[model samples]
Target: MTKHHITLAGAAAIAIAVAAPVALAQDATVAKRVDKLEKEMRAVQRQVFPGGAPAFFEGEIAPDATPGQVVKSNSPVADLTARVDALESQLRALTGQTEQNAFQLRELEKQFAAYKAEMDKRVPPAAAGEPAATPASLPVVAAPRPAAPTPAPAATATPPKKPATPPAASAGKPDAARLALVKKVEIPSSGNEQQDAYDYGFRLWSAKLYPEAQAQLKTVVAKWPKSSQASYAQNLLGRAYLDDGKPSLAAVAFYNNYKDRPDGPRAPHSLMYMGIALDKLGRKADACKAFRELDEVYGTKAPQDVRTDAAAAKAKAGC
Candidate 1:
């Protein structure tokens, strides 16, 4: 009877050992699956929130859970399910925010396009093949005639005859010589044909038609070299080249204006713009020299606007 009892015990021990390995294998498989799920959750969190996963969903110990005590479930499946639920909630929130940002970006792009269209309308392109109008020539006046000599009064005449009123003055006409001189030296008229031509070019410039404006202004400058508007046309021609991204050409135009008419009203402005064009060309040293010359020559004589612009340009160039 004692042998029989020992045999039964040995057989039970072998069975128990076999069952223990099977249970351990099942547990290992579950642990591996749980690890995989956790890794997937971390990847999702990284995509959703680049800064970091939220503290609440990061598997931190609950405030009420005591130190050294496990708050998670003993079953790995249950723990994984809970983590997945938290990740799903975070993903929903992140997706909504991303959509909102995308919508805002699209709206901003539309606004920018509309603004550009409106600006384009304000500066319409010049019509093709339209000829520029010619200015009318100034009228010439003839030189005054010499006055007739008065005959000597008779000795017997009791009273000198009153001096006869000049025929030209009596007719209310000005002296021809004086009129001619006045017309030659008169200030430019704003309503004259020359001014109108310049205005047409100025309108082209306002519309950002740099090529057309440059051509028109050149014609005005060449045709009316002695006109008061010559300085203005030359200065604006330089600006056209500058605005059209031809800084080298703009520098030449500006320099010419300054050199040709240093004391003209637009000379200081031309010098200031020359500095700006040189700076754009990466010739900062030449730009600084231009600015210095402007200040040295014009000083307080420069217009307030020109001086202000020069100062700003100088500061930007570190001059």
Candidate 2:
């Protein structure tokens, strides 16, 4: 019985010695595969997140674990599947961000198109060879009526010889002394811009400074074409030309006032002046027409001065 026991112990020891190496080799192979898998996972993390990788990627769930305890999955396939899910989630997030960026770009394009259309409406086309107008100097709005005639710069300004008499009818060019006087004329700034401009022009006209008056009146019309003073400035401009003996230019100025602002305070005066200008131009028939039209349009509403002037002009022209 003792010998049999010894033989069995020897057999058991040899069997254990041979099985140890095989088990150790299997464990080493499994550890090497795990190491290779870990290396591949780290490489994927670096490629996916160049900034940095997330922590604790192997054990995703530990619902019943205490502090410092994790329930790790033994299967490499489960870990790889979890990583694939993370990659898909990141791709979905990137796709959503791209869609949002495309939507914002479309909105910006729409806004730019609307702004361009608005600009086109505000600015008028420049004439050939003319520089484009700056936005600061552009007109506030489009004018409803045709522009008035532009007067020649031939007429000049000077003090009249007498209160009742006008400056001498000549080339009407300003000498150095007259220009110096014009420079001395005070342009008021009493907070009423249109009124102040008109007042300055009126003073120039009253002083028999026809050229300066014409220029100032034209500026008033250009700067504030919608102001109440526009009518007054336009009518006075015609008289300035008439006093300077540019009867043809005067006729055009007066006719424009009457046609453009028929309901203006100075419309009747403009019509009467227009007839006088036409008479000076030796168009008796047209002068007669102007005088007759004034009586027909504003028979009773005409001012006393306009009425008296019109009647005298009619008699002189045999209308």
Candidate 3:
């Protein structure tokens, strides 16, 4: 009997384990459906507004739209804006309607009051402690409507008021001069002997001269290896190789840069690309760990866009 009881309990446990995956699969399907709906909403918004511009410019509109399409789309979007201005004028006129309605209601109450007064005159006054005539006992006619609000005068087209004079402390400071100085403060060109080399490497990288850029970039790393720009140059070199379709070489470049300067501004991006290179190599597990490191250390500290990109990659890789 004990053996049978144990067997029954084990079967129940097996059933629960089987049910768990089924429930999770259903939830995942529901989540995917929600994602699909959100995508549809975005597609509809794009169809209505077309581009990335704001709601107002959404109708900046294509010249080639068919007459029917234009007519169909002739929304109150612009008129609504004009109506916002018209609302002020309408507010002034609103009191007129209220007054007109109140006057009509007041006339109605007065007529009813006069009729009551005439009927009461036809009946005798009742003695104290005695019941009064039914009509005499009736309540007084309705209260009179309150007086109308005075119409506001139209706003005059007053000349634009002069801008107020700024206070002394603020006026004494020349912010424009300060900004001009800041804008002109170019990093010293002749200050460092290797500046030309660094600048040339940057130009080459921008031009997509990967191998030549790497060669020029190496000049800076070899000459001024301890400088801050060395990390930037190394970051660019890894990018160059990645763009050149050399993932392994790119990984080597990024890994070396991170090893040398793990706390760099570019380090997170470098590590991210290293993971990409590993992904290209089909080393997914290692790639996942590398991505995990980015989340653990710098998720909050990193830029939002970078964090978003990293999270998306992690999700796509199912890590």
- Winner by TM-score: 2
- Overall lDDT per candidate, in order of appearance: 0.58, 0.59, 0.51
lDDT of 2: 0.59
Q: Go through the candidates in order and give the C-alpha RMSD of each one to the true structure.
A: 22.5, 23.5, 43.1
* Count of clashes, each model: 0, 0, 0
Q: Candidate 2 on 57-108: residue-level lDDT in tens?
A: 5422223222211114465544544555565466557656666877998997
Clashes of 3: 0
Residue-wise lDDT of candidate 1 within 123-202, one digit each (tens)? 23222111111011211111122122222211111111221111122225546653343223212223344564455456
Q: Rank by lDDT, descending?
A: 2, 1, 3
All candidates: TM-score: 0.41, 0.46, 0.39
What lDDT score is found at residue 32 in candidate 3? 45
TM-score of 2: 0.46
> Which parts of model 1 are misplaced by more than 4 Å?
1-191
Error of 1 at 65 (Å): 99
> Which sections of candidate 2 miss by over 4 Å?
1-175
